[model samples]
Target: MTDQGLGKDDKTPRTARGERTRRALLAAAAQEFGEKGFHEGSISGITRRAGCALGSFYTYFDTKDDIFRALVADMSGQVRDYVSPRIAEARDGIDAERIGLLSFLEFARSHKELYRIIDESEFVDAAAYRAHYENTAARVATRLAKAAERGEVRPDVEEVHAWAIMGMNVFLGLRYGIWDDSRPADEIAAIANALIEKGIGTRPD
Candidate 1:
């Protein structure tokens, strides 16, 4: 994960050491919640995992709920940070989607706890749960719009198309990334890219 602050609500660390401490706490929180879940997880577990004093946790977060909320946002940002640049290297809109899913599958395989933590947020923090997917779909919509402007995709692409593609990627990650790892990331991405190419790609013939 990036060495960045969790979110606006999180007490932004001032010093480099403080930033490191904050990142450690967030990483620890991911593990704590990822394995034991929100209810079973404790601040002590997080502090212990982080190898920091109890006071260090509170220096950045006020309560368990505060930290959990921050952690959700942090994880969401982590996905965006990991995937965006790779997508930028794509040859065009369709290839961008392929790269996006490929990177996401790779990220999910490594961060195996990501799906569990995000899934639990629906009950633990509904607002953050909604924001995660909504923001993701918005990014897809924006990408599709840009692609249409570039004549890479159908001119009629809209919000619903974005949601459909986002939904497909989410499930594909769950099945191929979390449930199994035998399949190559590019193989899965290629299959999905085919659908996008047929559904939306602009035709020259």
Candidate 2:
């Protein structure tokens, strides 16, 4: 079978214990790659961090590159799972974006290594890197479209608008969330949301 999406290939785990090991390896990889980077990080280091045997690595992953690819996909899914629900609880479309950014900021601040692993994926695995952002942008676009239909945003909003907001959130997460993190999450999100609220936000009657 083809390597479609994250769980691609027949090497997939078949048992509950297998899944736990895979998760441990990915978690260890995040810390390894996040700190040592893809080039410097070693498979040995991952196993050591995961407290698993050396040979056990091959049980789930074929090679170091393979694990890294899976790591990228895992991290992307983590962000979505973390932010999507908070975004859903938002009062409206514009508020949804605010919640999304706020949640992302918290995630980035806590998972400092997340950006490093993802950024390195751009160099190590271009396809996975592109897929992460493209998939995220698509989600944003869908949300915006629904918001438009519900009169939450400007009637003329388009895909470009969603991409723009996603771009904004990405950089904001990098800067305020990952880089400095001195400011409060709500404060930073509100500042960014202000620009969005006026431009895309629907006016009150």
Candidate 3:
């Protein structure tokens, strides 16, 4: 539920209806931005997609740039929320990673716009782009550290290791999730999991 980097303020909705309106705007913005890059996407297109008025758009976001930033944060939270519980259900630390990737592939397949929007954020909003990946890597590092404490992985597991794994997942998701999804998600996860296990799992001397 991390807000990425957005802060709550007076603009934040207090009513359920207001929240729904804001969410609709964000979802519509995702479609508009996803189909058309930031520069091409327009605020009017977002309102049209959301079935709301121009005034309604301003009700939640001050401008297109504002919503785009919010979208990045929202999507980051969405990914974490979708994958974390599934990972928590894993039998062990290594299994958690396998589940994590499997869930992410499924998410990417369904939300194909995810990659395009996130990638575009690198140029459109560098701060949000960096925050998204940094937050993701931090989560991975935390999980790895916990796994190590549980004797499930090498005790020396560190941030660099987490970044490495995150890097692999990002591309793996692009290949198996966005570009094409003919292959089974679990199959991809298992393959990647094996690599992670061999490299980091505890072993006997």
Instruction: Compose the digit string of candidate 3's lDDT tens values, residues 67-159.
Output: 999999999999999999999999988999999899999999999999999999999999999999999999999999999999999999999
Per-residue lDDT of 1-205 in model 2, one digit per residue for the tens? Answer: 2233344456788899999999999999999999999999999999999999987788788778999999999999999999998898999999998998999999999999988998899999999999999999999999988999999998888889888998999899999988899999999899888889875556785
Local accuracy of candidate 1 as per-residue lDDT tens digits, 105-158: 999999999999999999999999999999999999999999999999999999
Each model's TM-score?
0.92, 0.92, 0.93
Clashing pairs in 2: none
Please identify which of the two predictions, 2 or 3, would achieve the higher TM-score against the true structure. Answer: 3
For candidate 3, report its TM-score: 0.93
Error at 141, model 1, angstroms: 0.5
Per-residue lDDT, model 3, residue 8, is: 41
Report how far off residue 188 is in candidate 3 (Å). Answer: 0.3
Kindly give the number of clashing pairs for every candidate.
0, 0, 0
- Considering every candidate listed, which one attains the maximal TM-score? 3
How far residue 190's Cα lies from its native spot in candidate 1, in Å, is 0.1
lDDT of every model, 2 decimals: 0.93, 0.91, 0.92
- Worst ten in a row by lDDT for model 3: 1-10
